[model samples]
Target: MKRAFIPPADSLIAFECAARHLSFTRAAEELHLTQGAVSKQVRQLEDRLGVELFRRVRQRIVLTDAGRLYLHDIRGALENMTAATRQVMSYAGSADVLNLAVLPTFGTRWLAPRLAGFQKRFPDAGLNLSVRLQPFDFDEEPFDGAIHHGDPVWAGAIAERLFDEEVIPVASRAFRDRHDIRDPADLVRVPRLQLATRPLAWRQWFEHVGVETDAAFQGARFEQFVMISEAAIHNMGAALIPRFFVEAELASGRLVQLFDISLDQNTAYYFVYPEGRTMRPVVKTFRQWLMEEARTARTNREAMLPR
Candidate 1:
């Protein structure tokens, strides 16, 4: 079906590149074309759309409100198209391709290592993983499923629990020694690292241990657990991190667990897929394998805990 409202693909490419750099010359250099050619393509695209995308100011260029909105939607379309092309180009004899979106740190640490087992179990199946920090619309994205870290809530999706999140306070041995921290209350005066995504992490951890402090809200914030782990390793501050993530550091003596107390988050990690898609052979097999892995991991964790 031909859509007259949609501008030419090459023109969209020109517009995207020029809008990104705000300079036709830069866009031309990247696209391996002359500046005039890029400008002509963008002008044609604007004419077709009947809207001014870019506005000039003192020889520089900036996107108009329409340009910004178009860029926001088009960028994702381009990336998804690129991903689809790559998936097709890289295809082998695999029967089913599983496209998954996962949390970055969790994907790197947990699922990645266990992937060998899945590959061996289903040698005929292919798996692709992409990093996604939060929930997204499944319809708009080219994903078969996603590993979500929060609540069991996704529209038109089936949520299966992967594991519970339990976070504990940890710090470098040197930091602990320098601060003379012995009890949960002692942490209030020292540098505390905060997770930017969950600002209430420290407050909740403190409350779990029955420690009161107004300073829980004050600290250097890091966006991800990996960053917080690195900062804490350098003695930047004490950080509250998921226990599973810091096991290696704790064993290596790089980071020390502060107290036995931990905060059990109300939220848990979940493997979610569109409800109707569960009937697919690939999705069903993966769900079974994931639940098994989750059970094994949970068992091991519980076994190590003091009885």
Candidate 2:
């Protein structure tokens, strides 16, 4: 089957722009062409299609039925093509990746639950997360931002306070039964599970209650809060855990607090970004979303606490 060759691509582009805008002058302005040049291109396009694309009147122009239908279809196709092109370009530039670092326990027990909202808000952005054991060189790891626990004082980074971490002693039902823990002093008799990240937790809590214990350093050491809490749940020993992290387990009888004693750690969790890069669009967006998530987590944890 033989067919006539198509005309210049610019003519179809001119026709689509003019038909969509319903004004050759406006389309020409957008296309960086004069009105006369735009009109000529559209006319050439119509001639090739063997149809009138616009009906000219005294002071204005309008589309015929065929022109209206063609505009609707071609405008959609052009918009779709433009969007796809931009997406590909963005990927090529590596501008679509959001690299994040977070503490392992907080990432699982706290941050993981609230991430769907982040996904909903930034559907086009790719989120990549890494577990951070301690504050490190952000440039060395190539991280866009990180969640850290401490005094919002990460060196060479902009820190936004996210939440306060307060620890309270908790034990399994059996652990409490085996050791009579009516007062904070009784903690000395129970085997305490310790977090390697915060070595002085027991000392801080005991000092708050005016109790002293040499056994604070004697216990099973875990690198993460989740492991410490899980070990406590299995009746391995008592653990001083962030009250917020184990609220569900406490309410469901999976774990129980040995006493009402709670101590506020001097340090807190923060959202940290490169010192001079906090104002970047993607970093700003992720910071706002993460803060909102932290607020929600704090609210829920507060609601679950026993008064």
Candidate 3:
């Protein structure tokens, strides 16, 4: 496809908002511009496309099929442009800005709540959260530090051990009642829901319970742990997920432990920074606060266990 000359960024932005809300007036309000200005941008964009994109009915604007398709493509491009601009702006100045790459669920459940304390302690520092899907070249990225899983072997970075990991076989109480899972071995007979994030979770859980089941690989596999937990809660299957994520479900009787089998991942979470970044103030503050938070979490998790 020929790269058609795109409209101005502001014009494309206005068109996207208008297309999404299906209202130019609303888009104008969001953009903090006059209705006439919004209309002008849309007209500019439409002219650039040489196509009739929107239908002006009695008092409303509706998208044509062409408008919908263009909106989809342009919206994505506009979003990417916005993100790139933000990233560039963020890294412009100040060593006090701490950009942390974190695991998605772990960041939300464990790290995010403690960030307020970190902010209060280092008021001048700006804490930024970036999600790490898999191991990447940290040096090439603009991140200040990363809270990565596994050992301290990340090339071109200084990795400090944070905390060990654990997973338990869990399911909804309703699901437990419906299925005959009296023993850990019985889990093999049921649908074994799997989390794509932790590919080896079930195998470790089975080893803990002294079971050798190849069907561990079978069942629905979801990318996120939270999704797997939800599927388990809905009686989809048994999921071996991190203990922290399902605390509420376990306490509220929404989910239950199928067995006492708990296996350690052995590899702990690590606070990793680019090789030459040990003296950075923001990175140091973040690492200190994170380690303190991890200590608290370990104590709390220990207290919650049966005596």
Best TM-score goes to which candidate? 1
Q: Where in model 1 is the C-alpha error above 4 Å?
A: 15-80, 87-93
| Model 1 score (lDDT) | 0.88
Clashes of 3: 0
After TM-score superposition, the amount by which residue 60's alpha carbon in candidate 2 deviates from its true location, in angstroms, is: 88
Best by lDDT: 1
1 or 2, greater by lDDT: 1
Clashes counted in candidate 1 amount to: 0
* Residue 288 Cα positional deviation in candidate 3, in Å, after optimal superposition: 0.5
Query: CA lDDT, every prediction?
Result: 0.88, 0.83, 0.83
Candidate 3, which ten residues in sequence have the lowest lDDT sum? Answer: 87-96
Clash pairs (backbone) in predicted model 1: none
Error of 2 at 17 (Å): 58
lDDT of 3 by residue, 1-307 (tens): 3545756788888888889888989999999999999999899888887997899998899999999999989978888878878876775554478877888888887788678998888877766788987667875787888888877788888888777887888988888878878998888889888877667778778877788988778888899887888898888988887787787788888889988768778788888888765567777777788888888888997887789
What is the per-residue lDDT of model 2 for residues 230-284, given as tens digits with 9 covering 90 to 100? Answer: 8999989989999878877988999998887688878889888887654666667
Instruction: State the weakest 10-residue window (summed lDDT) of model 2.
Output: 86-95
Residue 113, model 1: Cα distance from true site in angstroms:
2.3
Q: What is the TM-score of each candidate against the true structure?
A: 0.81, 0.65, 0.71
